[model samples]
Target: MAKPQIYDVLHREHEEVSELFHQLEEAKGAEALELFARLKQKLVPHSRAEEAVVYPRLLEESNTADTTREGIEEHKQVDKLLAELDAMTPDNEVWQAKIKVLADMVGHHVDEEEGELFPRAKQVVSDQEAEQLVDEYARERDSFVEDIRLEQRDAAE
Candidate 1:
């Protein structure tokens, strides 16, 4: 079988995140909190790794730079919503509304990324580079997840 490219990895993650958010919508109390935690674990690292490995490459090329910048800004917006959600308990009345907004923002970003940025990236990045990015992004994302796990473990101690 051929190795997966960057988009393939990202697409899988996107689908997972979307599903988590969808599940969260119907969840309550502890279930909602659990879903939110899972979403954060997947999303934060994915964004950071993409910023590290994918966005920088896309930003270098004229065709993709603008779209990449837009994507980064969308990340910032999503992060802000996430932070707000984190501050409040899942039972808070505002939590559902805020999560809906976050989901919409993420959905829009994913649409643009898959529709625009990936196509532009294909135009500029060679197949070899795309494959290399898949590895690099996974490594970076894994490192972030490990750091989070360690931090959580320490906090519990």
Candidate 2:
């Protein structure tokens, strides 16, 4: 089998998060909170894994450095938004507004990653390096997700 490209792996995650955000926007009360938890669970790890496996490589390339730095900063902003949502109940007056803002912010981030970052990354790495990065990204992300799942499970219990 051909090794999966980093673009496809990241894009699949983007779609999953986008779908969760859609579900979250339509949900109310506890359901919204539940959806938000899932989004946080998925997103935090995905961003971390990208930073671990993707960003550093791009940061090393003068051609890709600025965009990679911007993407990293955007991830930090997204982290803050996730934290703010986590602190509030879904029924809070501002919860819905915050969710909309997060969705828009994420949508913009995805556009930049897909349109600019990925194309530039493609130029910076060889086909072999791209494939290797996909493997590394998947492993790193899955490990983080499992750790988060255990924490959530322990908290619930």
Candidate 3:
């Protein structure tokens, strides 16, 4: 069987994150907090893996960098919102507004990536290279998850 492409994995994760954002919007109290936590859990590693593995590769190979650059900028914006949300309690009105902004930003980011960046990337990267990237991205994602877990544990102490 052929290995799955990096785009396939990333795209699926994007869909999952989108669902979490929807859940966040509908949730209340502890449930909302839980959904927010899950969003962070999925997003941090997914973004890191793209930054660590995918974006640099695209920068090297793709002459058209506009889409990828936009994606990176979006990542920074999302990171800022995530940090703000982390510092806030769900009970705060401002926190809810901030989360709504995050959801909108993320939705736009994912649309851009799926619509533009991935298509451009596919033009440059061969299927085999895409598979290799998938492997590397998965490994990076796992490492990121471990690091975040450790940080959370330390923060809780």
TM, every model: 0.97, 0.96, 0.95
lDDT of 3 by residue, 1-157 (tens): 8789999999899999989988888788899888888888899999999999999988876554777787889999999989888887888889778888998999898888888888888899999999999989999999999998998899899
Decreasing lDDT order of the candidates: 1, 2, 3
Question: Mind sharing the TM-score for model 1?
Answer: 0.97
C-alpha lDDT score of every prediction, in listed order = 0.93, 0.93, 0.88
- Model 2 alpha-carbon drift over 4 Å, by segment: none
For model 1, what is the alpha-carbon lDDT of residue 17?
95
Pairwise TM-score winner, candidates 2 and 3: 2
- Candidate 2 lowest-lDDT run of ten: 117-126
Query: Can you list the residue pairs that collide in candidate 3?
Result: none
RMSD of each: 0.8, 1.1, 1.2
The order of the candidates by TM-score, greatest first, is 1, 2, 3
Best by TM-score: 1
Tens-digit per-residue lDDT, 1-157, candidate 1:
8888999999999999999989998999999998998899999999999999999989999999999999999999999999899899988989999999999999999999999999989998988888888989999999999987888799889
Runs off by more than 4 Å, candidate 1: none
Candidate 2 per-residue C-alpha lDDT over 57-118 given as tens digits, one digit per residue, 9 for 90 to 100: 99999888999999999999999998998899988999999999999999999999999988
